[model samples]
Target chain A: MSGATPMLELRGLRKSFGDEVVLDGIDLSVASGEVLVVLGPSGCGKSTLLRCAVGLEPLDSGEVLVDGNLISATARDASLRQRVGMVFQSYDLFPNRTVLGNVTLSPMVVQHRSRSDAEEQAHSLLDRVGLWDKRDSYPSTLSGGQRQRVAICRALAMRPEVLLLDEVTAALDPEMVREVLDVVIDLADGGLTMMIVTHEMRFAEAVADRVVMLDQGHIAETSDDPPAFFRDPATPRARAFLSTFDYRRRSGRASGSLTKE
Target chain B: MGGAEILFQGETISRLLSGLMVTIRISLVSVAISIPVGVVVGIAMSSRHLLVRAVLRAILEFVRVMPQLVLLYVVFFGSATAFGLDLSGEAASVIVFSLWGAAELGDLVRGALASIPPIQYDSAYVLGLSRMQTFVHIILPQALARLMPPTMNLVSRMVKTTSLCMLIGVVELIRVGQQIIDFNRFQYPTGALWVYLAIFVMYFLVCWPLSIASRRLERRWAA
Candidate 1:
């Protein structure tokens, strides 16, 4: 890779809640058009890392540079921060707004774009996500998968420099997870710069250009070859973490045995 | 005398209607002032600053603990002797009720805002919305829905509570009812009973619609 400024860079990021240190000093960077997937145990600060990077969580001591511009934790540069979009585990679409309104709100309100322009882009994004028909529907009316797709569309409406996905499918039903992940995988195919935190091993292996495993608030392992890393993790901690997932055995089977009618 | 006859005698119905108008004026003016002030205070109550929250909480509790009658007395009578600033009974009622309404509504606003999930704010913030934009476009709309029912309840409560103004010689609905009763005590004989009954219906007429609106909103939003 050339020595151009990394798309998203975090230097010595540290965060704590009260006395409990959730993230120790950590440094990481994602190159332009790179798809980096973060894997970790439940409390390993993977979500916090993404939150800090997006300025949702204040960092204890660190600097976040997006395209080489500093984003302070306290006084965030709104223009710089706008270039990073994030989707949460719970698809937090505005409950009061319809799907189309949710996607177009930021563009019209923050970006000061004309309503027609914003709605036009929103239409195409919703169309791309197969949700154009559900445009006028409130978030409460949609299924978990459909709401998640609208959320992805909402983030994409910003035309973010880098998008952060925080366990986007963790709240979905088993049958619904594949649909959300498929939309994300399609985004990866489109060469969007994304930093995703997920527990889905196979999806991570399929979509990640680089994989980083976090443990106890630190990066425990990094692998440029995700397939090799998934097959044979370099560290014992990563191996144990991957072992906890039953994805390999569960891949080709239905959830449970069914009795003959 | 018949109940209908007692109500019709000497422009009694007109007198009561004028008195009801006074009651509504006080309640409406108070509500109009309180809703906006209360909403602002409630937003302040939800602030992250320790001192701001504490100070607002103390004010909220003080208003909650003190009886509305006592507040009316303090503002009406106390301000006169203490501050040498005489206030009209209607003005005093307005001031007292507005303060009490704002405090109550502020607490309700605070609760409604708190009930919104933190993820809602996060989602707006990550989309590059400024704090004011997030509040106007996202938080306020959601909080307003949750706030409607309780706020309507407060309005009815204020309307009913405006009867307290009679004690300060405000000659509002209840005072007018008393005047009618005193004047017709011997002639109508049973006029006091009918007069009080009419007052009861008058209050019911004013408050019942407010409560119905509140319940309907609660059901619609809950669904």
Candidate 2:
């Protein structure tokens, strides 16, 4: 990889809700085409970090940058903020719109693209995610996995520089998790830069180029080698977090690649 | 003269029909003004600013607590005495009802906007849609579905509430019915009962379709 500027960067991020601090003086970066997975227990500020990164949550004291240019964490600059795309735990699809409408709305409305061009791109993105046939269906008609996939399609349609996933599969049923995760895995394989927050240990091990374990609003451990970190975490907090999941037993299956149907 | 003969009295039926038209006119005019104004106020009511929310809440409470008849009196009689404004009964009724309808519909709009989950905003914002664009394309469309049933209910209420305007001497439906009954008191003994029954049916005819439409929207959107 060339030694160019990082695709995304967070500097001295500090956030507090009332007296309780959620993120504390954290600094991180995702280089171009890197998949950096954030591993943490609930309430460790994983979701908030992603929210702040995309300007959904205002940082108390921090700067978020895209391609080395400072963007506001307060969401003052919308066009600059659009460089990042995010998918949430709950598939927050627009219930009033059909799948096609949801995918094309931003491009047509915000970016002012022609309807023909937007629809053309939307059809291709939906087709790639296996949702082209359901383009006319409202979000209420789709299953959880299908809805999440459409959400991914919606984000990808924007052609964001970096995509953020905030425990996107946490709300899915066990059977549906793989279908959604498979889409993320495919995105990673295609070299899309991403910052993912997840509890899915096996998928994290498979996809992460680097791993950061956050505990109690602080980065407790950072692993440049994901496989080694999974095998032997350097910090007790990181080890305990991994122990809660059946990481060892699932280690064998981590090597298996997901084939797109 | 029997009740049938009283009904065919000189210009009686035509007068009552015109009075019903007045009632429809007042309600329709108020609704037209209320919808757009209420929608704007409702969005303002959902603002995060404490002062904006508090002030709007105060206005909403005032409108809700005061009876429509009292409002009519305040605008019609009070304006004439206090401000030297000799507003006609029709104009006063329009002013009073528009204020009342706009306030009620504004509260409904605020609730509809608040009912939307915050994630919807996040979804739109991350896609680079401005706050206005988000509200228009994403938030407003979802809120409208939630807003329609209650809004229809408000329209029906406004239609029925127009009966109160006659208290200000609007000579609307009820006033017309009274004039008819009083004119035939000596000849038609049971004229009062028939006239009132007709007025009741007229009010029902105007309001019932609105109620049906409200329920239909509620059912379809609920699904």
Best of the candidates, lDDT: 1
Evaluated on CA atoms against the true complex, candidate 2 attains a DockQ of 0.62
When only the first chain is scored, the TM-scores of the models are 0.93, 0.93
TM-score of chain A of 1: 0.93
Number of the top candidate by TM-score? 1
Clashing pairs in 1: none
Candidate 1 structure quality by residue, lDDT tens digits, A1-261: 389899999999999999888889889999999999999999999999999999988889999988988888765866877899999999799988999999999999889999999999999999988999999999988999999999999999989999999999999998999999999999999989999999888899999999999998899999999999999999999999998985565567676778765
The prediction achieving the highest DockQ against the true structure is 1
Q: Which ten residues in a row have the lowest lDDT in candidate 2 chain B?
A: B1-10
**For each candidate, what is chain B's TM-score?**
0.96, 0.94
Candidate 1 deviant stretches above 4 angstroms: A2-4, A247-261, B48-51
Instruction: Candidate 2: list runs displaced more than 4 Å.
Output: A247-261, B1-13
Q: What's each prediction's TM-score? A: 0.92, 0.90
Write the residue-wise lDDT of candidate 2 on A44-162 in tens digits: 99999998888888899989999999996675666785689999999899999999999999889878899999999999988888999999999988999999999998988788999
